[model samples]
Every structure is written in structure tokens, then in C-alpha cells.
Target: MKIVTGRMASALRLACMASTVVLLAGCTRYGQHGYARYRTNCGICHHGGEGMKGEIPPISGRVDRIAATTEGKQYLMHVLLNGLNGPLDIDGVHYNFSMPPFRTHLSDEEIASILSYLATRGDTQPVPVFSAADVAAERAHPMTTSMVAEERRRLDALHPLP
Candidate 1:
């Protein structure tokens, strides 16, 4: 997906940020803080975490399972910071592509917001809430894509993802 940046991007989310009061009062706090950003930034490729054609790795209903464990949660954070390249076998589908890193462009809170939005998408299941502090802690030490892939391997050995 082509990630847009600069003045144009800000204009898109300006409306959402401005309406935070209305959203928070009527809906979940998670959606208001992260909705617009997720739509423009993440929704482009992940499509509200539903993914596409098995190549994007849906986060909608499955991310809660991955974020349940501490290690799994870290893996998710690192994937955002370090990005993920190569192939992943999810269920019966083969997902192979490069998930670009947002470490530089996206802030700690932004990453947390998006991840938190994803984590809470599941209905009736309790999910870990990603905070800015959590993202900051993980950001202290960064990893490479290969390292992240290895972490995924380790996490997957214990918990298989969707």
C-alpha cells in the first residue's frame, strides 16, 4: 500500500481529532483516539484488520489471541517497529510480503493506539490494552526484520496465529 504523509495526511484526521469529545461520549475510547489514523494509515492495507486474500494477515478477530501473552504482545510491537518480511503460514494460507516499519514516521502513542484498536476488535474477549508507555518501553531497544521474524517464529511455536 502507498502510505501518504505530510499536510494531506493531517487534514484527513483533523476532523476525527476534533470530534474526540463526541466519539468518546458515545463510543469506546479506543475508537476515538485511533480511528482516523488507523483508517488512513492501517486500514488502507489491513482493511479494519480483515486483511485481504490471506496475504495481509487479518488482525480483526485474531489479534486478541496473539496479544494475550506477554511475548506475543511484544512480538506485535516489534513487528510494527521493525517491520516483518518473508513468509508466514497462518492456518492454511500463506502470507508472504513486506510489512513496512512505522518506527520513524509513527509515534509511540500512535503505535499504541493502533495496536490497542486492533486488540480490542474482538467481541466478548478480553484483550491487552496497548499504552504509550508500552510502546515506549519496546522502542528503547529496536530489532531488525530478521530478528522480528525469529521472534514471530518463537511466539508461533507456543501460540499459533490466525
Candidate 2:
């Protein structure tokens, strides 16, 4: 067997260190923007994305799947802008509550960042990124919370959960 020289060993160690740094950075790519926003605005209701079981539907595991579809993406945008009311079922659990509107408190960019953070953080599958432009476009239409709830029903009919 060939033995590595001191120079070669040093180079290998440096390479390993560099690789580790890159891997760590990659793990933290979804930094504070979205998480901070979620904590401040959404965590009150969502409880850090874990929700309150039957009372509040957990968004962490569900959002990525909802964000996968065009209508579902729009639904998320509308829900953020307009809020949501009435009964909703997620993964066989029911949540009937009023989600207050954030349009007055958050900017389009902030909302998009929050959505992006939810979509990416701790998720293994690929999910579509929400841009500021998407939020702005939804903002232009200005649907009421009731309208948003109705749209959610329509979307559920169109794409029933399996």
C-alpha cells in the first residue's frame, strides 16, 4: 500500500474541511428571513408550524404538498392576504377557526419570504418558490376572507386530498 506524504495529508485535510463548511452552509441556506417572519406573525396561531393538533392544522408537512399545485399556491397567497374562516380538514383532522388577515401588517415581499421559508424548511421534496411578484399579483385582486374560503372549497373539489 502507498503511504501519503505530509503535503498530501495536509491537502486532504484541507479539502475535507472545505467540504464540511460547504455542507454546513447548504444546511443553513434557508436563513432567518422566513423563520423570523413565521415566528412573529404566524407562530401565534401555528405554534412554530406544529399547530394545535385538531384545533389548528399543522402547516409544516401540509404546505409543501399544497404549494405543489397552481390553484393551491394561489390559495395560500389569498389566505395570507385575506385570512380564512369556516371549517377546514387537513389529513383527516378538522380545524374551524378564523385566521386573521396579514395584509395590513406584512409587505408582499415579507409574505413571499414566509411562504418560501415554509415551503423549503425541513422539507425533502422540491416545492415551488413564492416570489414577491406572486404576492403582489394576489394583492391586486383583493379577495375577502369569505371569498378565499369559497375558493378553497372549489380547489378542494378540484384536487381532493388522497
Candidate 3:
């Protein structure tokens, strides 16, 4: 085999760098939008998905466990679109707060991206990625925050997630 030297080696290295840059950009495309949105819209309150001492529910490393199922995914959409209120239990901690709905400001795609990012966050095992269509399906049927909470109760009662 002939060895690559001088100009040939330089050209090869440049090509490799270009390819690596493209690959990395593509790799992060799925989560980048969600990350930015999450930071702006969610991180402050949720504290980078860690929550604030059981006062808020976290997204990273938690909750996405349920996103593994279809009904659970639907419940998540409802919660985002309609908000969640009253007392809730997560990982043995109790949180009582009002999570405002983002239906007006966040689009279906944005909501999907946020959830997909959370579900596939580095700290948690990746669940199914959400599609804009999925968010749209839930957006079609609007519900009150209390209604969403009731739905959450029904879902958790039927099938709990750890």
C-alpha cells in the first residue's frame, strides 16, 4: 500500500475535520432546539430538570420513565398544553403548585421538541421521541388544568412508573 504524505495527508486531514463537524452538528440537531427552549422556558423553575427540593417536578433523570408508553406520552402532552395543578407525588416527594399552560406561546413542534429532549436527556434512558403530530393530536382537544390533573390521576392509577 502507498503511504499518504505531504499534500495528500493535509487534504485528508482537512476532509476528515469537515466530515466531523458536519456529523456533530447533525447529531445535536435533535436536542439543540429543545435545549435552548428548555433553558429559556423551563430551566429557571425546574433548575436544569433537577427541580427545587421537591417543590417542582423534574424532567431530566425522571418523569420520562412514563413517556415509554403511548398513554403516558399523551398525558405529558396534556400536562404541557393544559398545565398541571394541585398536589402531586413524584419519586416519593409531594409537590403542590400550579404549572402554567404553554398552549398559547409554544407550538406543537416546540412542545414535542421539549419533551423529546427531556425523554432523551443524557442523564436518563431515552424514551420514544415525540413527534409534532403527537403534540398536535393533543392540542386539538383542549382541557383545563384540573382536567389534566384528573387524567394524570387516572393514568398513574392504572399504570404506575418508577
Candidate 4:
């Protein structure tokens, strides 16, 4: 009876271990789906150390400054959907690159995943959840020079830069 009891206990332990392994694998698969999508699409330019002549920005840890601000986050979503041109300032350096709009190509969820992946890359922290509603709002009320100024003004009211 004792030998049979020991064998059953061992078998139960093995089954538990197997179950844990399968559960972990499923979680990894779920996370990797988004990662894979980013690698296939955005990684082409962002990961290529030296970006296209004047097309893509290095989207690795280089986006830290922009990701740290409310205005910047909104601007990023705007740029992702609407694209950008003219004198652009990111991380204090100016890039006169013009990004063709990807609004039609990428859904809001995909764009959010791409941004989340970019933010979590390297030592950077993950960005806040970017909802489809937020993207729609930005699209409905596009950012103009005045809007940028207004956002800055709001930030100033809170922090009051010296």
C-alpha cells in the first residue's frame, strides 16, 4: 500500500508540472503574436540601425523622450495614423523626414501593439494603454499649431517649467 501511494504521488506531481508548462507556453504564444507582427512590419526600418535616408525614425530606446509626455504620446498616435512632414523635432534633434500615412494600412489595435512593443524594447518602460477611442478622438480633432500650443500650455500649468 505504501509503495502504491508513493507512485501515485509522483504521478500527480508530474501531471502538475506538465500542466504548468503548457499554461506558460500558451501565455508566451499570445505575447509573441504581437511581437511577431511588429518584427515583420515595423522592425524593417526601426531595427535597421541606420534608418532610411529620410523616411523612418529609429524607434528603439530613441523614443523615450517622446513617450514620457502626454502631448508627445498623442502626437505619436497622430503621426502613426496621419504621418508627418515639415520640420519635426524628436529627442531634440530635427528630422525633416516625411512619413507616408499608414492610417489605412494599420488598425488601431495593431498600432497600439507596435507602440507598446517599441516602448518595452530594451530598458524602456511600456507605454500606457492607447485605446481605439483615443485614436479616433485625435483623428476627429487633428493637432494644429494652436492645439500643440494649448497642450504645452496645459503642461506648463501643471509643471511650470522655469
Models 1 onward score TM values of 0.79, 0.79, 0.78, 0.56
Off by over 4 Å in 1: 1-27
Off by over 4 Å in 3: 1-28, 122-126
Worst 10 residues of 1 by lDDT: 23-32
Please list the C-alpha lDDT of all candidates, in the order they appear. Answer: 0.79, 0.81, 0.81, 0.58
lDDT of each residue in 1-162, candidate 1, tens digit only: 245566667877897787876656533466666767688787889886778866788778666678888887888899888899989887688889789888998899888888887776775356578888999999999998989998898877776765
Better candidate by lDDT, 2 or 3: 2
The better-scoring model by lDDT among 2 and 4 is 2
Give the residue spans of candidate 4 off by over 4 A. 1-33, 48-55, 88-94, 122-127, 142-162
Q: lDDT tens string, model 2, 65-119?
A: 7888888889999999999988888878888988999998999988988888887
- Could you arrange the candidates by TM-score from highest to lowest? 1, 2, 3, 4
Enumerate residue pairs that collide in model 2. none
Top candidate on lDDT is: 2
What digit string (tens of lDDT, one per residue) describes model 4 on residues 63-91? 44455667666866776776655544444
Compared to the true structure, candidate 2 yields what TM-score? 0.79
